[model samples]
Structures are given as structure tokens and as C-alpha cells.
Target: MTRLWNAPDDFPDEMLAGFVAASGRWIRQVPGGVVRSTRDPRPTVSVVIGGGSGHYPAFGGLVGPGLAHGAAVGNPFSSPSARQVESVARAAHQGRGVLLSYGNYAGDVLHFSEAEAALRADGIDCRTVRVTDDIFSAPADRADQRRGIAGDFTVFRIAGAAAAAGLGLDAVESLASRANARTRSMGVAFSGCNLPGVDEPLFTVPDGRMAIGLGIHGEPGIAEVDLPTADGLAQLLVERLLADEEVPLPDGPSSARVVALLNGLGSVKYEELYVVYRRVAELLDVAGVVVADPHVGEYCTSFDMAGVSLTLLWLDDELERLWFTPADTPAFRTGSVRTSLPRPAAAASTERPDGPLPRASAESRQLAARIVTALDAGHAAIDAAAEELGRIDAVAGDGDHGVGMRRGTRAASHAAAAVAQRGAGASTTLNAAADAWSDKAGGTSGAIWGVILRAVGRELGDEADPTAEDLVRGLNRAVEGVTSYGKATVGDKTLVDALVPLADTFAAAVGAGADPALAWSKAAAAATRAAAATADLLPRMGRARTHGERSQGTPDPGAVSLAVLARVVEQSLSPVD
Candidate 1:
């Protein structure tokens, strides 16, 4: 249990603050995360790596002389926002190009891709390599879909080494991709982890049983069996890894050489790990594999999870050489590092003069006030249903949907209220809310809501009051944006499943001469029905796709949240009797 915290929501920020204060020798505080306090003597490709904040050494602890140049940390079990990633990359860039690497989760991919686009727009040469090395997440035929686990260390180390060697962005990316291709990892959990203030663990295993093929983000394992002894467990791990012939062994003279890591997820102590690794070593030797630079400790972890994982990096000449490169960081360290001068402090920003608001019609300002009321209602609705939503999502997903939705809606409501109080128009208020929701929430739901609100805001300009036709048009644009950006369709068991029906129904009602309030009410009802019908769907997108059968009896959490918000907004719009 996570007992020490000011507030559950403040845990990530508080943890990061203490980390920077204690580790000032290696890292410095930045807008999104920490960056290396010292600089290399010469320019090199910046290796920026990150993900959600629960994994300690994985992100912040790895920022140092020969490892990651910076890390973009996010909320617990949530990917960093695009704005966050962009800020860290900008701070870490040293005239040379940047390489962004992280686990291959859906939210991480979306935000990182957005940051990559933004960096390119600013003329910064940036590239991305997603780590997909968890063997059990997907079959060999769909290796690209696997989640990244402890194998992230192999990929990050190689990328950082290539960069420190003064390789160009192209070469660095190639080496990181190669590292990911050669690495394989599998994890088992004896128990689940608890979030900061949550009363229970995300999942649990029966006594004397163990879960296999678990994920780091509080997801339960795919299969469970009776627990085995230390030696038997080592054999199970080794045999499973050796059975995967699809990831062929290293070629040439190094065909039998490999780098093995026995990683503790979180609560498993060092002594127990040593016991397991003892037998793991014997099995590898018997199988004719020569281990090089074997590591046995925590590398990547779930917060306080009782689990361990085994990672094997099949090595060739170049990889083996890179693996032995010296590194100095707060967590992992190797051979001695060369002395380097401290980086110069960043220039302080001067406060800019405030500007007057753009003129807007009184009618538009009146509608903006209503928009704020609707946002408040949406926040209330999500807050009330958050626990239930989390329960539904935990069936197959990471179980953070409810928490994310609550955060987004709360931010959106506050932003909308502040902008509306300043006499802002409907468009400006919605746009402010959209940006706040996305920035604070930081996940797939955040990104999708940002798109939905922004698309609608564009159609509700400040010049005039919006009509039923305008509302329908804005909703249509939102639907188009979501489908295009998220690549999800009606039956994919996502928010799009409910969003599509709601938009189509509203558009039809408005076209038939119904008022905006009536159209919205009808649409909200349709969305509710659509959300409930998702219980029968097999999820074909996002993390749920990996455990599709597990989600069969639960409606999609995204769809349910969308419907709940729509109903609340509709109530705010309808005229009281």
C-alpha cells in the first residue's frame, strides 16, 4: 500500500520533486521532467526516454552521463501529454537531432507521435523507436503489437550508447530498432499493485497461485497456475524464452552469446532474485548459451507489484560492445565515467504584457456561460461514476479510464469557468477547456476529448450565436476528427461506438427542424443505448484487444463515460418545465 502522500493526485509531482532535490548531481528539474545537469563535451543525438511515472529508475533515474538525456514523466500509469514530451525534448536538444523511445502502449504512441509532428514543425530533427519486446502480449505473427517490458533497458542502453558515440540520428534509430528486435521478455506476478489512494489492488491472485504474462500497468495476467519453487520457476522462464524460435539467435560467431536480466517487478527483494538467478544460470549453461554481463535486479517495475520478469537480449558483435559501455545514473551504473562540465543555466523568461480579449456578441457570451454550466455538469457526472468506470475498465484494460476522465473533466470545467468569467466567447471557452483537459489528463481519453472539443469550438466562432445547424455541424466535425485521429470505428468498442450514433442522431434531428435542446436530448438517449450495447462487443482496439475475451461482459469504459457526459450536458441544455 502507498501510505505516504499529500494527495493521491499530487503523488507524481511530489515524488518527482524529491527525486530532483536528492539527485541534483545527475539531473535538473525541467517543465515536464528531469534533464541531465551535465553536458557532453561535444554535440550528440539526444536520447529522450519516458513513460508513466510509477516505474522509478526506468525514466527519471536513467537520466545521466551515458544514458537518457531527459525523461518526460506523466501521471501514474498514464502516458505524458504531447505538450509535456515536446517541452522535455526542446530542453534536452543540443543542436543535434533527438531520438524519442518508450513502451509501445496506445496512449504513449499517440502522444509521442504528436510530439514528433510538433518537433518537426519547429524544424527540430526528431525520430521515434517504440520498444515492443514482451513475448506474451501478442503472437510472433503480430510482434509489432507486443507491449514493452524490461527489454526497454536493452533498447534504451543501445540508443544512448550509439548517441554518445556521436552517431547521427539515423544510425541511433537503426541501432535502437535492432536492439528491440533482438530482445524478448516475459513476466509473472504473485499479486497486483495498489494505486496511491485506492483501497484495493488492481487485481489479485489466489493463494499459492501465480499469474503468467502480466503487464506492468496493473493489468492481470493472461493465465494463472499453482506457484512453483525457485528452481522450477527459473526453468519455466528459461524454457519459454528458448521455445520462441521466431526471434532467431544471434548470428555468426556470437550465435550462442546473450545478455540475460532477471528483473524484480517491485516488492521482490534482491536475495530471492539471487536464488532464482542461481538456477537460471545453470539452465542457460546447459542449453549451450554463453551469458555476457548478466544483470539481476529491478530494471523496470510496476508500483509495488509482487512479480518478476526475465529478459534475454540476443547479442551480436556491435550489440555486445554497446552493452558494456560505461553509464552513470541514479539507479543503474557500470564502469567509471569521464568528468564533464556542468551545463549552463537556461535563460529566465520575462513576463509579457497582457492582451485585451477579442470582441464578441452578447448572445455568444451568454452561450459561453451555458457552456461553463454544461462543463460543470459533465465533471460531476464523471466524478460520480468514476469508481464504477474503473471497475469496468479493469476487466481487460489498465483500469485508469475513470481516474483519467475525472481529471480531464475537472480541468475542463475549471478552464471553461475562468474563460467564461473573463467575457470570452463560446469558441474561446471551449478551446481553453479542451487544451486544459488534454494537458492535465494525459492519455488516449485526454487526446480524444481534446480533439472532440477543439473541433466543435472551431465551428462556434465568436462573431455570432450558434444555431442548431451549427451545433450539428460541429458535432459532425468532432466525429470525423476522432475517427481519423484514433483510427477507431463504430464497432471497435471504443468511445467512437457511442460518439458515432450520438452525432448521427443529433444531425438528423436538427435537420428535421428540431431545436438544439431536443436534438441533444434525443442524441444523448441514443448514445446511452449504444454504450450499453458495447457489452456484447469484442474489443478490437487499444489495450483491451490483447484480452478481448475478458471484456466480453463489460461495456467499454470510454463509451460509457462519453454517454454519461452527453446526458449531463443535455440536461444542462434542456429548458426546465
Candidate 2:
């Protein structure tokens, strides 16, 4: 590395200690690897953001107008000292109140709390905001335990700008909380990062796999899985972000869409970052997840580590307007983005659905019962997987896919059980039974369930002993319907990736003179393989693509669930000789 002192003649002030020192007074540091200061906070508002040393653009580089008024740098992966935090608070408070912000971490909390106390003792009116934007870090109810990650920059930028605009401490505090609520983040670490001055990385995970919840400093994760290509990773992030939405106040997604940021750690190239951002923006755009203000760059980092984090901030009207408000800064700059939050719509009919109609046979109803039983048998795994997936989707797609699927499957089973009691026909019974699924499921699953059962009803139209030939026809139509209804194809990282291929295989076996049992077996087997194959594809179309390469290897739960359904259907179709 070139020596800064000996660099040729006139180097940029950014690299000079005099410039750094003159920019602000030496405020103290805070918790979670953050530093703080009040000293000469530029333009109007005082801001704070800090982390460890190596991630340059982070703790120190963000200090400028419209950014941090002060930073509280921690000791590498540790928290900043209390004195450091106190200095920041003292510097930031200029009688107009001071705004303190940083990523959520234990050390940061400890130090910042001390700083808050010290500030009040010194008669300075200071308020601190914690960044807890990562949806994957903890359950929403337990978000206080989550690590803030990169989305902290958005919260700081917006809130800091507002404070500069002369909003009092209350307004700043409210804006900060609202932005934090609107924001969610998730990240995948391919390789562990080294702690400065250490001989080795903090920990290690196998190459070509992702550490799903690896802390910025190499904490253990919810799970570790094979690495994905870039598109797959992007989709994973996007899916989690959308899933984290609060059901959009009973209105559609347009009202729910908000400002989004695609942040890269220090090591990720801008080239790769933009590639991820473009695909994610398109996915969000298609899904109606708004992009009022879109930021794509390295706003945070883990010391040149080869990984990235995804963050979404759900904007209310005030947040949207504030996020776009003009304020110059060395790191963040933006214009206005129109954000809307729709009023909650009154719910539709609440009556228990009409009793299952006639037409669904005892056998088919039995099939539904069996599927439900299988799900029930694996309830723990289902719930766990759903929880994990829900966390994942919270980063990228509509957040409720897990809960939605769980609800849909359980409701379908319940409806079948109810219909069985009433002796409803296979077609009518299943149709009415599916009403619960349609009403209960949300997002893509809701639409998929509607098509799936409609095809079943079509084949069973008032028939006695509808043969496997009838089943084949229904399956074929179902595949076509899924393709048509979703407008997503096999490689788009969708359930169709498994469903279409399975249906085709089943139809081919039947056409080649195989018996119903044999054909069904072939299709079920094909579906299992196809579902696994999806891990190899990127989420080119949906929330999965935003996860990019990080999504590879983890089979999509929807596709896997579909395969399971095929297996159940095939077994049900077989009869004793």
C-alpha cells in the first residue's frame, strides 16, 4: 500500500488526517461497533453512524452533509467505548437536539446507552435510534435481537436529513421509527471475514455454500446451504423483503411498495451490485413492490468480504417524502419518491364457506385427507421450514408465502374433511373445499390453488370412477393453467420449474402405453428431481432472482411441496388388483 504522507504532491483531502480531524470534533463511540460525534456536524442536522475500522465507507467515510454528524467506531467486531459515544453525543447536541443512529448489536447498545445517560447528565437533548432492519435475524416479535446490517444507512440518511430540515426531536424520532419499521434486510455470506490484525478469519464455512445468517463478523446462522448463482441470490433477498410486509393493510402491493436499497459489502464489485439491483428492481416492479427511492451501492461492508446484504424500507407518506428530500452528502444523495399506504379495506364475506358441493368422490376426498395427513405428520418440519422460508421471503418476495402455503394446505384439508362428512360429490366437494384455500392463501399460492382445483373439478365433472386417464387430463390442464396464470416459466425460478416438467413426464409415460400406476410413479419421480433442479436456476422472474447466486442449491419450498402433492396423488390413484 502506498504511504499517504509520501503520496505525490497534492492528494485529495479525503485521505488526510487534517481534513478528517477538522471535519468534526472527536465525539465518543457507541455500541455495535459505532462511533459518534457532534463537532461541526455540517449544514444543519447532527448524525451518527459507525462500525469497525476496515469497512472504510462505513464508520468514517459516511461523515458528511446529509449523512452522519458523528460516528462511534467500535473495536473491530466489538462495541465502541462509552467515552467515545459520550463524546459523539456532546458534539452532536447544539441545543437543537441531536440524532444518534447505528446498527443493532449488543456492544453498541451497551455503549450507546451509556452515552445516552452521559448526554442527559451533560444537559444535552439527544435521542438514539437502533437499526434492526434485517428480517432474517430474528422473529418480528424478537426483532430487538436482530443485527441491523446495511439498511442502517437509509434510516440514518433519511432521519438525519429530516433533522437537518429542522424537524424537532419528536419528529426525527418518529421518522426514524417509521423508517426502521419500513426497512428489512438479509444477507448471505459465502466466506468468512477476517478480524483485523488476526491471522485467520473469525470462522469458516465450506466454499460454494451460503451462511444464511452469518453475522458481519462470522456469527453462526439459521442454516448453511450450497451457494447459488447471482440471480438466485437476488431472488432470495427480494422474496424475503416482500414476505416481511405487514399484509399491506388489507390492500394490494402498490400501497405497500416503498423505498428499497441493494447494498454490497466492501468486497462485492459495483458491476455485480448493479446486476443484482437491476434484476431486483424489475422483480419488485413486476410484483408491485414500489421503488420510490432506489439506492444501489456499498453503503456498508464487512471489511472487503465477498458478500452482499439486501434491505427494503417500507415508506409511509412522510418517509417517502423525507427519503427523497434533497440533502447533499458524500455517500447518499436522492430525490423524491411517491409512496402510498392504502387504508385497510373491509374484509369480504366471513361466513363459513358453503359445505363442499357434490361430485368429489370418496376416493378423491380420501386423497385430500391423505395429503393433509402427510402434512400433519410433518407439521414440525413444515412449520420450521415455513418459518425459515418466511424469513427468507421477508428479504425478497411477498413475505407470507410460508404462512400462506401453510394456511392453504391446512384449509384445503379441513374443507375436504368437512365435505366428506356431508357426502359431497368429488367435483363439487373439492371445488367448495378449495374455497377455503382460495380465501386463505395469499400472493402466488392463492392464484395457484384456484387453478389447481379448477382443473380437478373440470376432469371430475359429475363422473363415477373417473379413471387415471381423467386424472392425467386434469394434471395436464393444471400444468397449462399454472403456466398461463403465472406467466412464469420453468427457468424463472418458480413452482412451474417443477410442475411443468412433472406433468410433461406423466403425460409421456401414459402416451407410451404405461399403466396408470406406472405413469403416476414416473411423474412423481420426475417431479422430485425437477424440484431439486430449481436450485440450479436463478430467480429471473420473481423475488428469488434478487437473491442472485445466493439462492442456488436450496430447493424452493413451493416446488418441493408440489412434488409431494404429486406423490400423494399418484399413490391415491393406485387400486388393489
Candidate 3:
């Protein structure tokens, strides 16, 4: 439960509700999504925005002097009626015209499209700028068929700026179309959310897993992978969005600039949102995408849901300048958009050897392979454990640890497979795999897994010859990294519980002059034992803590997954027997 207020379940329609009474948070029941504006203005260039009610400032916040002239409020996931759309449009039009902006959804299409007709009939000059983001929803060519997730902000700024510039409705609408062409979005939901007045969610994508391209209203998605970390998740969304075989870079002064927005559906704090924003900005910088104007915090939302979405608007010379041209609205305040374009990442020179970091011997390769396979086998068990953990987390926390773990695992496995097939050096291979995991998988698990692989790789460096001692040292270092960054210990019911035991077992086996294969086997056994022992231990942190006693009987999902990883190493040791 968030420290917030909600309208009573049975409140009458059109009643001032949802907001705390007299808190001036501003609440009123408008039909469907068509909430009339309370602002004092017989405005010009009215901002008529709507979607489902939960998106917040998306449809409402952008309604102000430098933003929307008026807005139509809708029920959550439900579009305002044509009448409501036209009404808001009428309220916003000054003699010039109305600018219609909303996420791309079926209901929105029907309602807003209908509103266009109604406005034309009423002699109101109204135009629409639909935001079709969520690249994962469809192929880029087919994005029009997909529902908009978070790209509405870009459309708002572009078209809104044009309106602010006193451009005719035609030019403003054209700018919106260009923004729609350039913008893209994707989102992940670990758990489902409930609609206001409804006891249950409309749908669910499952617990401990993420539905890529998942609809804002709990609809199905492109794929279901376990959850990843904030940075990892940010990467997943960005990569999938830019996964066009290649994104054509704009020419400098020529190259394009970008405005980034990290939208928390709800429940996440602004502080955490900025953390994500910084990561995305860093990645964009790497891609040569300059940040012209970055907007964070909750511009759009899903009514207390725990997930977040990213929106990017690629800007050119014309669009970039218009971004900051003042417009009035309740949600967005105009700010400086003047900035330089980002340069492409520096290219590698031919001077140094850039071959695969360092290859491992056949024996070491076998060890790595077995560890990878074992991790794969435990996928089923990991899923079950994650689901249970998520349920527990939902009671108190955001209920996404399980999902994050699952996503990270899937990505890690895929990355490992690609690396092994390529005959890359051990450390280099691990780094590559970790990057893949962090990119495909999202959330905390991916982040931790990436850290673990990198730490181990750093120890291994480029090595053609290695002793058991060397391997043992690397394992120990990896464990240290996990423990250090994850801030968890053996009894915390995290993967460390199993990995810690594995590290100890590896050191003992290597000391006893055991074969690398046998050492890993022993490590696997120890990991399994430690993971099992977790069933009786209390979960002291993260989502597991929310269930209290309920979590006591289930093994930690993280621990089990770690055990699986150990087995993969053990299995890799066996010959083609």
C-alpha cells in the first residue's frame, strides 16, 4: 500500500474523488476518459490528452499554460467517449485548433478518432498526434499496429512545441507525426495490477517473470523472461527498441539528439527513477545519442503498479529547438532544450591486438560447460521458487525479485551458449555472456549476475594455461563480488547461500589435488546442500521477507539457481561418455 488516497469503491460518477478531499490534488469523475478542465481559461491550442485514468499527468499533467489547454480524463485503460473527446477539444481550442495526444490504444483510437469527427462537425479545428511507442509490441514497420506505451511524452513535446510556436494545425500535426516516427518504447511487468473498484487484475503475465511489451493494462507481451535489474531492464528496453538490425544515425549538428523520459507507472520513488534515468542516459551517450532535455519522475503511470517504462524521442535540428519552445499545460513545464549532439563511441584502432581476451584449456572449457548446463536444468525449479517468492513480496515489497532472477538466468544462459560456441577466451567469454544477460534480462538479478561474471573474468584475464589454484582464486573472487555488491550473506536466502558453499568446496577440492572436474563436482554438491538448507531458514531481506512464515518452507530461488550454475560446471567436466 502506498501512502496515498483512493476514491471510495462506490463513489458516484462525476463526483470529486480519487484525490484527498480539499487537498486540492484535484479529483473529479469525468465520463470515460473525458474529464473537463478546472483551469481558468477559454484557452487556445487546448491539450486534450487521455488514455486510461492511471497514466496520471500523461493525460492530465500535460494540461496547463505551457502544456494542454484542457484534458479529457478516462477510466483506467478505458478511453474517453467521442463526446468527451470532442468536449475537451472544444474547451481547448482558441480560434486556432486543438491538439489531440494520447497513447496508441484501440479504445483511444475509437474515441479520439470519433472525437475528430465530432470536433469537425462543431467547426472546431482539431488534429491528433498519436504516440505509438513500445517497439516490442510490433516490428518497427508494424509499430502502428501496436499500442503506445510511454512514447506519448515525445509526441507531446514536439507537437506541443509546434503549437507553442504558433504553427498552424497542419505543421503541428506534421511534427507530431515525425516524432511518432522517431520515438519508441518497451516495458516489463513482473506482477499484475488491479483496476480501481475491481478486486482482481484484468490479466496477469505471471510472477517472477517479465512480459516484454506487456500492455499498460496487464495485457500479454512479446516474451516472458525473468525480471532483470533497473540498469539491466533499462538496457533490455533500449536494445529491443533499437534492435533494427541497425539504427540509422542522423547527420551531425548532422547527428540526432534525444530527449529521454523514464516513466514509473506508479509505486516507484522519484529517487529510484533518476537512478534509472542516469543509466539510460549513459547508454544513450554510448550510442552517440545526446540528451537534449531529459525528463524523469512520473509523467505517465499505471496507478501504483511497480513497473517502469522508458521513452525516447530522436530529434533533428528543427525538432530539437522546438522541444523547449514554451507551451502551457498542467503536467509539463517548458525548459531549455538547447544542447549538442552526442558523438559516436570511439572506434578501436588497429594498433593493439583485440582478439578474444584469452582462451581456456580444453579442461577448463569442460568445467565451464558443465556449469552452464546444470544451470539450464534447474530452470523449472527456479521458476517455481521465483513464483512463490514473488507472492511473498507482493504482500509487502514490489514482488519482483523472482521475475528479475528468471530474466537474468535466461539471458545469462543464452549469452553463455553464444560465448562457448565462439571459442572466446574464458574471461572475455564470461564478460560477453554477462553483457548479453544484462541486456536481455532486466532488473537486479541480471545486474548481480553480470557483476559476478565480470569479477571472475577480471581474475582469469587472458590465460591459455591455468592451474587449479588459479581457478579456485577466480571462484573466490566472484563470490566476493556477489557478496559485496548484492549486500547479502549466506543466511540471507540469496544465491550467495549456495555460491558461498561452492567457493569453499572448490578451495578444499583444489587443495586436496582433486581434478578440476572433480573439484567442480564437489562444489556442485555443496551448492545443492546449501540451497536445500535454505528451506528452513527465514528470508531476512527483499521480497521473501514479506511472507514471513510462508517463505520459511521454500528454498530460496536465488540459492537454487546458484546451485544449478555449479552443476553446469560439474557436468561440463564429463567426457563424451
Candidate 4:
């Protein structure tokens, strides 16, 4: 239902440009995202937050005095790359240290962790707090695995306030973690959201059914139910949130104190939210819970998703004080912020590394050329199957898999081709491709692919042509790298399902003295079979897990795409016509 946009790929950049232009007084544009235009007089711990682009006010809108010092924005429904996060953190740090915070997500975790390591290497102290507060996303025993949703506001606000008060990085991070523990949220969707340039919504609900325990990124909900009246829905939301043990108060329900946020996902009207909140307030009053600053509007949103979520932040003494701290931003302003003398701007750097390329044998350079050609064939395969992949993902996911794959492969092919043209070795070309793929794609799949390429690249040195054993070893390393980082196994209904089979079969074939190309062809066939077999399995990881049953009949897009790329790579190994 997101009708207003030019090119979908360009939307994020355009939106950021307009936001900066409109909020110039409060924020300024940086390479990755936005930072405060006015700096504090004294050095203070910087609070930086970020995520995908569609969740407005969540990230950029929260940047200003007494709030986030910077935000590292990414593509729609994608986490920012490590380079982007490092750039924003560097710009925001005032020398006291930096605290990075964001919703807990697979892609966000990988990229932010990388950025944290990079900052440490540069001698800047850094820490991270991943907000995991969506109670419905995981069981109580597995609360740490829950995805962060609208409750991100509570954690971010507490961290920002702590930092603004000149608290050290440790204190700020602790408070942020505490806030995340105290917050709980759940959501429902009447319909799915349409991404810019997409012709259809990510997923759909039956005409009279509603999706319960839905994620903000258009992920299919956990369950379906008959649509309830406004008051009935409000009761449902309040009842669930109140049941959480995090809500603090006297033993009696009526004496409980809480900070409440009733958020509209996107297309839901304010009037509709207010109507629901009316019943929600009545239920809270009946239960004896006292609500503070009960916000009712869009705090975090999915583009045109007809859904809403309720966040309850249980307040202890410290949390209450931080919650009431002064804040001024493009959206959501409260209390008053003290003005401080602006710090002087740092000088800009205008230099690039002037080093010679690493030595690469002519045979290795020839192999690099073949790698470029293989990437091109892979890119073409992804392009050909993009729409089908998107459709498959729509069964239970956000339906962005095809678009993301297209972007990543295109970037990888271009980077590899460029390096190969310059007589780079296979290792150098593959490494550059890995970085480009991760940077341009900006999602879970992208990060995994980056790991895959880099692992293979490291195994194949520039000095010599990769032997069959070397290639098989690299593939094994890639499988291990992906499994370790993504926490997914062969039966997890992820790309690992296909990747593991391919790697194992190829290695087995090589061990039996088969030719590399012949072994790859057989491995590709195994991957194809495994990918198809995923249609009968239920998803056990990622957003699709919420609607596991719904995804039973559809092959995982990630698995299928990987299989397709494997087939293309096999074809690339054949002699040219």
C-alpha cells in the first residue's frame, strides 16, 4: 500500500535527504545516517542507535539533545553495514566513549559486532546493548532470543538519557540492558505492508481474520483469529502485556506503575489507535496499574502495515527517572534540555592509501578472471529468479529476499570484475566481492554470503592456482563459518540446508579423485534437491519461524537462491563456447 515513491532502491537515500533538510536545526547528515548538529561543551559518552529505514523516529527521529548522538541508518528492512556503523560511531564519539544500541536482530547483531571490534582497534572504547523486548517473539525461558519491536523506544531512551547525563559507557550500557529487561511488547496485523516498488504486500491475512503476535517488518503473524472489535482487541493487548512479570508495582495489580506506548505500525489511523487506547486505559484502571506518559501514535512503523503494537515499560525508581529525562528531537520532545557550547568541528581527511597491489601469479590472475565470470553468471541467475524468490518468501516472510539477492550479487559481480580487470589475484577479487556484497545488501543473507566468500578467499592464496583439495577445504570452512555465525544447522530450514549438502557432496567427490568441475556439477545437483526438499520442512529460524506452518509448502527463498547460484557457478566452470 506504499504508493508514493520513485525508485524503491533510492527511497532510503531520498528520505534521509529530506529528513535532514527539514530538521537541519536539530540534526545533520552523515555518510551512514544523522548526528546532532550541536555538540555538548564537555566530552560525554555518545549514544548511537540504528536499524533499517522504515522504522521512523525509532532511529533518526530520536537524534537530538538528550537523546541519540547518531544513527546508522540502512536500506529498507536491512541492518546497516559494519563500515556504516563505524562511520556514525566515529562521528558521534565525544572521547568519553561510545554506547551502541539497536533492536536485537540477526543482521544487526553481526554488523554491529563487527563495528564494535573495528572501533576497539581504532582505540575508541565502545559497547553494545541489543534490545530484546518483544515478549511474543520467544518463550519466557528464551527471552534473550526475542526480537526487539516497539519496545526499542524504552531501551534507547534510557541509554540516551544516561549518556546525556555524562554517565560512563558502562553505566549507560547497564541502564539500557535493564530497560530492555523491563519492557515487553506484542502486536497484531490486519494486513501486510507493501515495500516501495513492490507490486504486492509481503504477506496477507484472510478477509475477516487478524494476525496476532506479528513482527514489525511485515513478518507473518504467529497465529490467526477472527477480527475482534476495537475494545476486544484493546483488552487482548492489555491482558497479554500485564501478564508479563516485568511489570513492577505493589503485589496488587492496581498499584502497578508502567510507562505505556500504543504504537501504530503504519497505515493505522490515529483515531483508530485512540479508540483502542480508550478501552486499554479502562482495563489498566480496573487492574490498578498507574500509567505514565501513555503515548498513542506511531513510534516505530512498517510501511503501510495495518498493524499496531503495545509496549509496557515497568518502572523502578531509576527507570522512572531516566524515562522522565528531558529530550528534544524531530519526533517526541519532552521536558527541557540544557544548552551547551558547541564543540569545534574536526578537519576533513582527503587521502587514500598509496600502496602497491599484492603480487599475484599470472595463473592466479587468470583464475581471478574466471571468478569474475562465475559471479556474473550467478548474478544473472539471481536476476532471473528474483520474482519467484520474492513470491516464495511472501508465504511467511517480509518478501524482500529476491530484491536483496539481486542487489548483493550485482554488487559482488561488479566488485570482482573491477578487481579482476586490474590483474588482481583470485583471493583479492573474492575478498573485494565479499565486502561489496555485504555492504550493498545489508541483511542476514548478505552477511552470510560475505562470510562464505571471504572464507573461500582466505583458503585460496594469491601465489598459486587453487587445487581440488584447496577448493574443497575452502567450501568446508565456508560451511563452518556460516553455521557458527548464523547459528543455523542443516535442518534449520535456512540456506544452511542446501549449503551443507553441497559442501559435503563436493568434498566427498573430490576425495574420490573426481575432477573439480565434475564434482561441482554433482554438488550443485545435490543442493538443488535439498533446496526443493525444504518445501516439506518448517522454518526453525529467522522471522519465518513465527509462522512456521504457513511456510511448510514453500521452499525457503534463501536456500533456493543459494542452490540457483551454485548451479550457475557450475556452469561457469565449463569451457567457453
C-alpha lDDT score of every prediction, in listed order: 0.88, 0.61, 0.61, 0.86
Tens-digit lDDT track of model 2 for 395-512: 3332344655665666566775666556655565556545556544423564576577778667755445556666678778888887776667778877887887777887788778
Q: Output the better candidate (1/2) by lDDT.
A: 1
Best by lDDT: 1
Clashes in candidate 3: how many? Answer: 50
Per-residue alpha-carbon lDDT of candidate 1 for residues 1-577, written as tens digits (9 for 90 to 100): 6567788878888999999999999998787788899999998999999888888888899988778999989888888888788888988998899999999998898888988998899899999999998898999889999999999999999999889888999999999999998899999999998878777788889999999999998888988989999998999998888777567664522356889999999999899999999999999988888898799999998899999999998888998888788889898888888887798889111112335667778877888888899899999999999989988888888788888888899999998898888898888888888977887788899889989999888888776867777777788999999999889999999999999999999989878978777878899999999999999999999988888688998999999999998999888855111
lDDT of 4 by residue, 1-577 (tens): 9988987768888999999999987888877788888888777899999998888877899998878999989888888887678888888888888899998888899889888998999899999999888888888778888899999988889998998888888899899988888888999999999888889888889999999988877788888899999998999999988886655355745666788899999989999999999999889888877897699999999989999999888888888888898998899799988885654455112112434567898877888898999999999989889889989988888788888888899999999998788878988889889988988788788889999999988888787866777778888999999999889997879999999999999999888978778889999999999999999998898878867688998899999999999999888855111
TM-score for each of the candidates: 0.96, 0.52, 0.53, 0.95
Deviation (Å) of 158 in candidate 3: 2.0
Query: Which TM-score value belongs to model 3?
Result: 0.53
Provide the global lDDT of candidate 1 against the true structure.
Answer: 0.88
lDDT measured at residue 304 in model 4 versus the true structure, 0 to 100: 90
Worst 10 residues of 2 by lDDT: 340-349
lDDT of 4 at 244: 68
Better of 1 and 3 by lDDT: 1
Q: Write one digit per residue (lDDT tens) for candidate 3, span 1-577.
A: 2223355222213222433132122222333332322433322355567755557666666654444545665444455445456655654456787778887654466557766876777687777877877766556566566567778777776776676566777887888889888787777666567544444443355666776666665453446788777788878866765565323354532265777788787777788878777778778778777788888887777666777788777777888888767654445656542231221223111122335535566754654564356446544445556655444333323344455455556656666666666665556666766664543333345556666777776665545444567667777888887777556787887778888888899889878877767777888899999988988888665434423465576677667667765665565434111
Residue-pair clashes per candidate: 0, 82, 50, 1
Arrange candidates, best TM-score first. 1, 4, 3, 2
Superposed model 2: Cα runs more than 4 Å off: 1-45, 245-252, 334-577
- Who is ahead in lDDT, 2 or 4? 4
